[model samples]
Target chain A: MMIDHPLPPGSTIGILGGGQLGRMTSVAASRLGLKTHIYNDTPDAPAFDVAAAATVGAYDDLDAIARFAEQVDVVTCEFENVPAAALEAAGRSACVFPPVKSFEVAQDRLTEKDFVSGLGIAVAPYAAVATLADLKGAILRVPPPALLKTRRFGYDGKGQASIHTLCEAESAWEIIGEAPAILEGMVAFEREVSVIAVRGQDGTMRFYDVVENVHRGGILDTSTVPANMAPRLAGEAQAIAGRIAEALGHVGVLTVEMFQTGGASPSLAVNEIAPRVHNSGHWTQDACLISQFENHVRAICGWPLGDVARHSDAVMTNLIGDDAGEWRQNAAEAGTALHLYGKAEARPGRKMGHITRISPKS
Target chain B: MMIDHPLPPGSTIGILGGGQLGRMTSVAASRLGLKTHIYNDTPDAPAFDVAAAATVGAYDDLDAIARFAEQVDVVTCEFENVPAAALEAAGRSACVFPPVKSFEVAQDRLTEKDFVSGLGIAVAPYAAVATLADLKGAILRVPPPALLKTRRFGYDGKGQASIHTLCEAESAWEIIGEAPAILEGMVAFEREVSVIAVRGQDGTMRFYDVVENVHRGGILDTSTVPANMAPRLAGEAQAIAGRIAEALGHVGVLTVEMFQTGGASPSLAVNEIAPRVHNSGHWTQDACLISQFENHVRAICGWPLGDVARHSDAVMTNLIGDDAGEWRQNAAEAGTALHLYGKAEARPGRKMGHITRISPKS
Candidate 1:
């Protein structure tokens, strides 16, 4: 999206979704003297505690979206799952950063894969499936040991099913709620990693280090910096992230999840791109000079993006549910960085907080 | 002046100044999921923008301090210049972190020097001046080219006068409003450094690296991390800071500014201690795993202290006066961290914002 220079402070940042991400974005924006308006479907969200303005309404609440978009100078989303209709609503009045292209590429798994591959980017072997017959055919094309993912709105292992063989095909497709889906042959990956890149309206792009992520039951559990991998593989992950960001003329933080096929000839492949700041990029707030949230704010507001520089090699661990009990121990770590999401309940698997350890040198 | 088991979060943080510092303290408190009430004399201060509550009355207003103190869980100050009387009043009602000891130490230069020396800590040579006769006598002991600073409520280079000889004594004293003051010999130092440390209510302490700071006209201009000093001297500096915090029973982040007297075999001498998060520690917001402000909130509010561990080696430059004009440049330096203190004007020497850079290890 095209943006003019210097969207001054005091301008309201129209934030879509009222989760912890929105809460943090609001905090960041407030620190810079900017106002933030949070619009979300849920009313009892944690983000509401600190936000100055909030509209407790659904994404499809056009009237509210119109008023919100009109009131703010720029629009941004906390999560990528924001419906295209909602994004279009915000985009109609204020410039939606990351652009509609970002959402379009990210909303559908097949489309994202096609977009990445079309950019001459490497993706795991995949094929599209609209029917159960198509799923069976896709399995024949790839292998019995493959996965089926719904084209839209899948996160943290939801909306996807693994098929060990054709016997599980129909049930798997049925489990996905019969949405448009993609079948993908898995890569022999040693680790999962993500790159958080920020691009500006002026075509300036910056990439943070490739952070290796570990998932527990499809939920992000930890993200460690330095990727503790070969320099070449790390560089390749960052390069692919940069390429993907530039290809879409992406603005704000673009988080690309990739698999590092750690082998004799170590390599990496793109998994998916999160159009906004993702959970994986949370470490940058404590580990890097420029936090992913600040960069997102800078990019969306038409301000020059700050440096994507790493100060300390770091590790970020998520505190889900009962893990929050360790807040005391984590906070006492002298150098371990702790960030609580301000969530009140430690519901099972709910992200309550995180801790980061930044080691400047070996 | 002893404290045990850290005060917990959801407690209150009492701030003294209602300006940007209080504003920021409130912001940090809110981020850590704590409540903050800024106890300043101004109703229209910048801090009002973010605090849960603000007391707009005189610092010497005992009724106001009592009432304010009665409402909070724990008390902390935003600026060090909070009158001793106000601290006494507040402490009568609430558990004031840092105690009244730090206030006594900060209010009088002579007391500070004597206190540091009494603790077997190093300090610049100095003497007290209760009268013009005392000024002459003090200078005779310390020699020519000394500094005469008012014993109380002096800040922003005010309440200070430089004395070269006995001939300049009366005018120098008068320049400081003829208030009770002290005459100190010059500190012939190679560099100025500060240790920003957090002491929990439980007595647990954490320290950031020794920061080399530069001052322009008595106001901090820049602070560079890994201050390029010997680790031994840094350790000495940290030790001195820890002693000071322990001595005061300080809880929350306090900064001990010191002079590095020599280059080789360098020695550190106490200059002053800010009982709250100091401007020099602002870099912690980006350079460390936990920011001093957040840690300060955690400390005073009974939350556990976070790691004072820095994520990267860094440099922080204050955007004094019109220097904020270069914010765009700073913002554009990929990974350059920017923090604008919501001050509207760009007056000469005013701290409007700051930029920090955290360098990754090669």
Candidate 2:
């Protein structure tokens, strides 16, 4: 199917999720004279604040999804977990980016690892586990002190547990419930980094600078661009990401998380992939000419991608839960760009906002 | 009256008018985690598309004004012509930036000119005209080749006529109708520039670089930062604008347009003042670290003023009417940032959007 060329300014872009990513994307769409309609099951979604219109309906409601898709020129999602039924409906009516194939691969841990490994990208040893016998047998080759993660519907620190010993495998499996899962061998790495790359409708791809990520309590804490890794290694990460994007025939933003393994001559190992605009790319909003959100919208609208040059060195720190209470000081500080999600409550461990401070390159 | 220390995130900001300025202001406010409620009489106002809440009610509706004010932490206007009654009603419930004095001084051409002249600023020669007799008498003093502009409700070269001779005086009076007006002598100037300044609630003030503006048919066509005038003369213009802002005890953004006259250390004559974010300041959005819209939001929120230094040289060209059809080319151009108002129609002479091209400083 051929997608339309260069959507007109007044056209509507439909977004699948109404989280912070959707909110920021909608804001970017508005900047280009494009309106956004957010579809989410959650009431009072943050994206509703900035979107032109919103619908709170279950993702499985094919009727509602068809109505939404029929109303917009293009359809995109802020998260990889969009139900296949909804995507199928939207795809029938409008163009969906990162394609349904990309979603199918990213939504499952084993499939994502298999897909990256198929591209000849190095990934941690992994074996699927549908039962206790599968886990026990997989542990023989995958080794102990491995991560046992649910194959679906998991994010942040949830749906994963460490198997420190053979005795702990059953408890780990019990903790993740009866969901199909994967057992992965852990790797000793110096640091973590991610590449934010976007693929346009015509297959043109652009990558922003690599970002070094720090996690606390299994949640992203900070992302610094021009990641302290060697330039050669950063280039390698970009190549790996580009190859993955091309293989998936992906459109819109694709974030490839990698681990810097070995010392002296470091190499990248694929950690996972997020087929959407990522939290680690938030610094691009303040440090670059065109932000990841804007690039995503441009990619889906079939418009030419913008320049991705970084004019400044930047550090982005996430404000989770109670940390957002310091917004006053953040607003008062010079060089700080504060962004709050406008969530109703500050539940512990929930993302509330982020602050990006940039220093112009001298 | 003492202003509050700071407005926390999640607080509501009520904007008095809904237009492109209001839309951009709401987007900036949302960036800082603040919600915005747009109050305008027009149906489906452009600002309403991005605002959290909107009320389509007349400014003179005291009951609606009171209810809107009660829902917001602070109130600010997107234009200078906010009705005095509306201001009074909102003031009783929430803090209103720029106060009523700034509005009174800027709403009337005669009063605005008188106020600037009283501040010891050089202004074009002017005399008040309330009737045909007054126009005839003022023409003799103000001179033959001059303009007669309505004292109120005048903008974009509307409600004014050129008086070239005694024969044109009666026709000019009839053109302006029964409204009291101002007859002003023309200033022979080489170029026009504007200063965008903001005063915080705590009285701390900041000014962005002066912008040189070009007009076509009395509507702003382009605004370029770092005007081509001598640096010393630019400094003088800034000083004059700073003094006006201080005299008015103004908060939020204040723009003072000036005309540079004569050569060799050209002197500046006060042209007019906009007590809100002005079109000439739009270039700051892409060139400066903190945009005029963000500064206005900070001032009204009682947060400290942000850094206003220009990091890039910028030229902003307005996409009036059908000019917005070139959005695809603008989007494709490198270093150019496109902003559209999300307006549904492209009426002739209407400002639909703007394109700003920025060159990063070496």
Candidate 3:
């Protein structure tokens, strides 16, 4: 789809969520002389501190969203969980990038898997589980050594349970609170990698170098570029990401996480797609000509994507919970770029900040 | 001098004199989880768009400045022309970097030259001119082929006139509004260069690579890194900047602009000193490991200075007047990073923004 016109410097961009991603996106927008108005349910949203304007209200509040949409030149979201009704209301009055279809596909695990599989992409075998009976039947096909995940509102490994055996299917259904769910057969993956890419309003697309991701207790702990994988595997990962962006008609940054199964060839499996900036791509902030945040803003504004080549090798480590207590030492280290989220609390498993260390590639 | 404590994340950074410098600086501060309160004389200040809080008042408003300082953990100014009384008032309530003494020396052309010369640094030969008679007498000592410039409030070739011969002394005095001025004998320089360096509260200092500057009608047109200069001359410039920062006990970024005189060795002559972040250092935002703005924030907060190394060769060109109209073309250019100040009007000679293009160093 072609954008009507490119946003000028002084236009205001309306962001649908006020988290760290929104906060960093606001900073990038300001650098381009664009203002941002952030909307989030929490009163103490971190992005509010840097945004030109902000509203503390629920995404489902149509009146509030309508007012925000009317005031901004374009609307985009930081997270995929933005309510479909809110996007519809905003879309009626403003340009909402990534469209509702992409969000709809990614909102449910089963729909996302079906969409990718329909595109001839390889996905772990999955079955929809709406009730205990559905779970009982799904176990017969998907089998044990699988994951039963809630269909909606799941992140950072929450709202999911591992099914080690058929006997545990009932407990897994109970663990997910009897919510609509999906059962996916386990794949013996050697490692996880993700591709962060952006598509302009005019259909131009670009991708950053694939990054290898490491998680600790269901939360992202580290992301390193130069994933050290077979060139063919990396190329396949990027191709999958590009095809997904094109399929969704995406007009902003999107990330596709994949499983690299252990084998002589190391084939890749489609995991899940995020229709917004991803944590795994944070290293680009220090190593590339343009960061993912800037490219997102550029894409939504109908501008050309910036050069995404990395001139340095970088490792990004997330600071979770009390990890921020070592900020002093991190700040003292040379070549360390420390970025804090400005969150008031550092509860266990909470993402407080991140640090990226870079060195020029030889 | 040692700071009692380093300002932690979420601390407020009070910036005086809101402009493009303040806007960019606030963005950098936000990236570190710091909030900024901007003070400027106009409500339409570009920096106000991104600042967390803002005060519209003159620098002479001691009450407002005092209140701003009381609310922030540290105070810094974007320009040296900030009233001494305002800084004195703010310093009473908060930590002000690059202490007022440095401003006193750099605010006036005569005092700046004398201070640098006192450190055994070579400066342009000069004589003070307070009146027409003073100008006539200064001609005898400074000789012809000189420049008569105001000792204060002079920037970008404003408030200055060239004295080609002794007969033009009366006209030169009239041209300068009979203000206190300095007559300096011109040096036959092959090129101009500037050194951007920072000094922390604990007295640690570091310098970025030297940049060669080109002027169009006395305004900065372009700054290129890896200045094609003799290594001895570059080293001398860095040394001079370091010594000046040490002598003034500066606690933030400062720039020393010098003339690379034509000769077999091409020795340097100190032309001027700025006690705050300089426009010539803008390239550092993209070329160096850490930007000058971030370093300034780090210095004032008593944090360790970041590495000041460049991994790429960069050329920064200022977009003045209607040059911003070509922003789309600039944004589409590979390797070019575009920045636009949210200025509503692009009057003649006004700096709308700048673009920096970089290439990986071989």
Candidate 4:
């Protein structure tokens, strides 16, 4: 499944998930004359509306996954939670970007912390807990004012509980369904930021400007480019992301979320990593010459990466639930680009759309 | 079939052609959470690769066109050559943009010339030639050094012949297959330029910067925004396009191509009009907040028009036939955005792709 040359314009890239990320990636692929085939279990997946072809089958269905892979020249994923067996099945038929090793580390919270720390990177103190006795030991080592989170299948503040005192460890574990978990000592920080980096098959790397993120109710609320941080600190954040990509032998787009601690001297600590296109990089769609989704397609297809420079400073706001109801107002506003995902329902906490407002750099 | 309200997300737009314009429009529709169903006579049409659904039927198939229109909330065409009967069939089932009146005026060369002149717009002097006697009479009125072109199905410099002398009139007429034609006296123009204008259902209008175009072998080679002209003349060009749009009661995007006659006082003569998204506006995809394709979707859907302001100056070069072979080199160049149409072959004179380079506005 090793591709020695770039895939031609008509080749198809098979995608593992069918959400907003997949939908945007499909549009990017079309711009480059490439075709996309989406594989998702849901019948009405948003990505299905734009992809050249689609397969509605379970991720673990090895036969179906292999067939989907066989039809495409290469394979990539929109999310990291895709099962290892499915990726393995796809690998037998087509080359997969960001390799399975990266996904393996990103899928498990404990493994990701260990991987980042192993590279001599900054990470909050953490300990693994599989039972009540292990939780007690972890609380003693990691201390209170910590978070008890499931090792896998957690997103958007889900599958997590707060332990403010040692006495709350048992209840916090029960709240997470007593799953295999990790206790992380929360870092008191001033701001949260993310670095979006892309690596080509040739090992050439490009990093977008550090993006400052604000979260409400644990979901991304807004992402602004040219983060309000010193240039030296931004460089360090990008360097850390570069080291992670190099260590994992990652190809395509990878995102690193970090916490910035404020004091007399500021510093950054690795929070987590996502092995695919991320929500925090959505502002690039309107502000930069090449978007993260387009770069992902170029990287996976073995094409040269494009310019990462921004033409204007931008702020991207997410549309959650009823927030999408204000699309008319957003559309009427000048200099605003509104993007709505074709979801039938705007259930509470669901991401329905996003809008980006750009202005000349100050 | 009149749509008084904006179509909601997840609504379908039926497109009548599946060429590059339709392909790009479909991608734009997807960005707004809208789905597209493409109808083309060919099975492997470029647009079908990205649409939610597709129907392969002839334009003359009234029943098929009606059925296709019935499945969508609105209907639009990518090319003006679509049969009037086909649009009529679609209009019976759904609201069609750029209305049939505009298409009727655009489809016939003689009709378009008379319509423009009737509206007090400058156009090349022209006479209809339906018979050999008409050509003899037209030669006296229109004079030599004129173009005798077919009234229908003429594009990209096709179906045209030049008459440089009085004796050449009959041969020129025979060269165009003796179809109903028009003989337009040639004007000594210094440059070719175009204006892309969009009109909304609410009678709002927005105009993009005038673009200077270069043609090679009768097909567009490049389009540069901020056309090299006096500010007053550019404004005049826009005003002329606005008058035409108003006269036709047009909705959606319309393009008016003009010839700039060089002299102490440079004046514009209307060359022709396209009642749809056009090639000259492609630069907006990278240089402006909203592209012509996106704005066309908004106008046809009864939504507010977007800002037409550009953040950068751009030069767009087309990749025709063998020119696409330089894609690797183009990809390596910084500050360039390359777009390919997903066509399998690179036939001579075929538009395979385009590349645009942008820089901060001067």
Candidate 5:
């Protein structure tokens, strides 16, 4: 795509979706002198408040999408799960980044796992289960204490369950609403780690320092950069991210989640990949001079990619539900960087905001 | 003073008059999830490209101002020289941060001096001059080598001339188009410094670590944090800013330019106050985790102030005109942070961008 779109400052960047990710992306894009147009199905979408233009219409609404795409210079989605049809529709006249392949792999756990495994990368022991009987057999092979996850549209503990015993088998399958699934032998890992790497349109790749991620109930809880990984391991993780990005011809930041086991544990298995920018990279906003959000904007804008150097050793903690309600306390705490998502309701288990702290790394 | 216009994330921040200050402010507001509407008289206004909605209309166009403000939730201006009527027009219905009082002071140097004086602060010995005779008389009463500056709408070595010798009077008067002016005794100063402070709507004020500033050709060239002042002196400087903010009831970041002079060097004396956010605070974006831009957003939105604590001793260097053309060298320089304002041309003397490098104080 020869994007000579003449996207100067004040131009609107039409974004598909209005979650916190989109909300934050809009924030970064706006900082670069670009206006943002958020298109999402929900009227109450969080990003609506901060955007220049917004279309509260379903992704499938042709008229709405056409008008939405017409309002901005280029279009990008906050989440990778934007339907293929919706992307094709908005991508007609607007330049969409991360390409359609991002959603293709991102939308399905099976395809994503295969894509990772196909790259000669490490992933949890996994098998595709297209039917109930196939799932049972795969479980029999993989054994109990395996994860049965829907192949499509699963996140934050939704559309998935652990098969701890046979009594929970049918119910676990039913909990996922009988969707197509991927069964995997769960890896007992010491810690979850994620590497967020950016690939510019010109084929240059840069990675933020590795972030050791902490999650609770499947949702990201915290991420500390300059993650306690050996330099070689961090380099290896970055290389894995780069390979995936280059393989997908990916533009913008790609975050790959992995499980580290071994030594004291079993070690090193790929968990999943988020083709777009990830929450795990949020610490970049405060810890690195150029944040992941800003780098994503720069990469997508056809500008020279920025340095991803970390400014300080940092820790990022997500403020979930009532945790976000403690912003006053968090804000007053010295050296802590508080970022509130501006969400009205602090619903239980919902991500409301996060805090990043920079401390001496002695 | 009530802001009935409660714009959330997706709305536009209508900026009246786009300049470098507007451009930076637009960048800051966007990072907090607000899209911008940069309305400047010229098409090439620095802030326009980064905004979503822009109107190219003369400052006096009330209809255009109304239309622009109607489309945005809040209206903020970069230049205070905007005709009071023009500002009043834009701020008629929309929320305007810092309001007209701040703009009024910035337009006239004499009034600004008096305003600061009324706040029990120090300003240089000053006198107003509506004519050349008044200018001559004011100068005789003040120091032999005093500065004669246009009372309204002067900046950056423009709209005013240096008066070194008595013979330069007619030319100085003519060069400024014989505008209403002010004459002040030039204070012998050890250093030029500024305090960038933000006052929240709730009456709290937050000041960044006082910055030591260096200017070349009347343009800000470098700013270093921990301005190396005695801790008490730094506290005194911040107190001055707080008093000014409280007096103006200012609701955004205000950059107070001051002269540090006296005894071998007298310490600091107030020079001028910028009603809007200032360039001197640019280092806050990278050195301080919460940034001046975010603070501006918080102050204007009636949100709580953020931590302005510096993580490291920080240095900011301006990329003026062709200076910004050295993007490659700056980008390649390790540990030196680069920031490009996305300006297309690097015209001579034009401020294009800046760089910041934060090092710990030994």
Candidate 6:
């Protein structure tokens, strides 16, 4: 069916990838009287537990993607790495949010950095390394104390290697299987923060408060809202995110991670951008009036964006793996909201759940 | 498979209804990493959209109820009117919250009043009126400006009639289709309010702040938290609800609607009790640290009750029928949280959704 903007209640939203993000987005859609049809390669995807419908198929299966898309008014993704071909297939049957351009730019490290820097946003100095010859030359420009990240299919510190010096570059590249990579020179940053922003179909944009994020083992450990930064710096981060969204003509929630140098005068450099909801924005679920997941559903559905104001300061801690076993204690704690993805196993480093502790803003 | 107290994440909660309450409760269950299997009589029940599994069967279908219960670790009802036999069937396979006693008491108005009044709690003076002769005699004891309501299967102001005077008693009784009914004398009250309270499996109780309610066309129009009452009176209301919950040895959330008489010394009279999550408590979803639905899930799962502290003041307005059409306007309003049940049609008097507008506490 041909659907109009601001898809009415009862309209189905086709979601690609059925992980915790999709689970949350499904819940948000349900809250708005909308239904979600989740498409994932795995049968026991986390989001399937909350969606109205589910389709299990390979991401590159164009027929399956088209069939899934045909049943919904619009399509969106829980993860940024959705195959371009899958999104293209979905686009033939349903409107897709964040647009194909946004995903294309985000799928590669070099392209993402180039896109953001092209918008006049500050980014860490970086150079592409496609071969051993390229690596030798690129290291001179983007030197040691840097990261060699594969251009695609990298997440949670995987497909990445650290290069501490010129001599270690080759071994570091070998560690990542010598994949085409981007060499990003490390910045002397004291804090890492992210801006969770959303753009509506009408070009309206809303930004949640910048959140300070800490990563442990390359997975988001905790995110504290109202990042301990000057308001001016936070606003600048939001402005940079807005510029990126505008340049991409993006719709739905877009999260931009940044590195902040600490001192009397701190400067921010765009680290990366997630074309979907980011783990760092999970704190909004408990601290703000509207959460990133809800806003994403709103934006993708072509509805008006909600107020993204925080009511309290919050620290959201991920319960990776066995940490979820302490749920009883977390449940008993006052002022803590515990959320767990219904994953049956607690594999090491897997995000089993999260808890957000909120206190009145100072 | 046996389940222990403080049911672990991934446990299935079987809900016995599939309306908006069930939908929201299912979402809450999902947030805690719990799955929900909803059993409802209709195919298009709203809760099915969010549930992990759903069984379409009559409420009194013992076989179906048992089958659904067997797959779940625990059972709970979204509405109090669930048949006693259904609970019995479910109880055979899984633990049922609020217990059959709670449902039995709440099913009949006379039994409910007697049960509450027996605990030294003030309830509206009421009398059983099974026939015209009974109505005549009961009206003499309870008097006019009273309500003649069916003893069972009454909800949203249905199965009720108002008796303005002695002569209107017969007509009022006829209005209720002469079902086994009760005659309740109206209290001279300044406001209507309700206390949403939850009792854990261990008998621990937590009460949300009393909320003032207003009805239009016999349907809940709005519920304002921190009801305009003295703290003392609010405490009294909560204490009264606690007493009822304790008396019933209730588990999960129980709501008590009350009539508060105005004067130098305000007094509260129990209007009725709902043995499940209630509509008036919808504000908690937006304004409180933990909502009634989440607490209900926590309580029934044999987990510790969450903090019931309000972070902001809120007014929750029900979107009865056509009111949901203005979702765009509500969505655009700042500080407002709109929740729409995925109902396909907005028939008059049908609860389509609700919007909760919150503000910093005074």
Number of the top lDDT candidate:
4
Per-residue lDDT of A29-105 in model 4, one digit per residue for the tens?
99999999999999989999888999999999999999999999999999999999999999998999879999999
Write the residue-wise lDDT of candidate 5 on B133-170 in tens digits.
88777767775577788888778777767777767778
lDDT string, candidate 6, B222-326, tens digits: 999889999988999999999999989889999999999857778999999999999999999999889999999999999999999999999999999899999
**Chain B TM-score of every predicted model:** 0.93, 0.98, 0.98, 0.98, 0.94, 0.98
Q: What is the C-alpha RMSD of each candidate to the true structure, in Å?
A: 3.6, 2.0, 1.3, 1.2, 4.2, 1.4
* Backbone clash tally (model 3): 0
Q: Give model 3 RMSD, 1 decimal.
A: 1.3
Q: Which 10 successive residues of model 6 chain B have the least lDDT summed?
A: B1-10
Per-residue alpha-carbon lDDT of candidate 2 for residues B75-123, written as tens digits (9 for 90 to 100) = 9999888889999999999999877889999999988998999989999
Chain A TM per candidate, in order of listing: 0.96, 0.98, 0.98, 0.99, 0.96, 0.98
Candidate 4 residue-wise lDDT, B1-362, digit = tens: 55788998889999999999999999999888899999999998889988999999999999999999999999999999999899999999899997999999999999999999999999988999999889989999998899999999999889999999889977887899999999999988889999999999887899999999998888999999989999999999999999999999999999999999968789999999999998899999999989999999999998889889998899999999989988888887899999999998999999998999999887
Which parts of model 2 have CA positions greater than 4 angstroms off? B1-3, B164-167
Count of clashing residue pairs in every prediction: 16, 0, 0, 0, 23, 0
TM-score of 6: 0.98
lDDT of 1 by residue, A1-362 (tens): 46667787657788888787887777777666666778888886656654556788888888888888988888888888778888888778888887888888998899999999999888899999999999999999989678899998898899989999889998999999999999999777889999888888888788888888999998999898878788777788888988998888888889999987747777778998999998988877776666788889988888888767676677889888989878678876766766676566679978877787777644
> What TM-score goes with each of the models?
0.88, 0.96, 0.98, 0.98, 0.86, 0.98
Every candidate's lDDT: 0.80, 0.90, 0.90, 0.93, 0.79, 0.92
Runs in model 6 lying further than 4 Å from the true structure: A1-4, B1-4
Query: Distance from true position, residue A170, model 3, in Å?
Result: 1.8
Ranked by lDDT from best down, the candidates are 4, 6, 3, 2, 1, 5
lDDT of 5 by residue, A5-95 (tens): 3345456678888887887787677545567788989887777655666789998887788878877777888887778888888888778
Tally clashes: model 4: 0
lDDT of 2 by residue, A64-90 (tens): 999999988899999999999999999
Interface RMSD, prediction 6: 0.5
- In candidate 3, which residue pairs get closer than 3 Å at backbone N, Cα or C atoms, i.e. clash? none
Off by over 4 Å in 3: none
Listed models, DockQ each: 0.40, 0.70, 0.72, 0.82, 0.25, 0.94
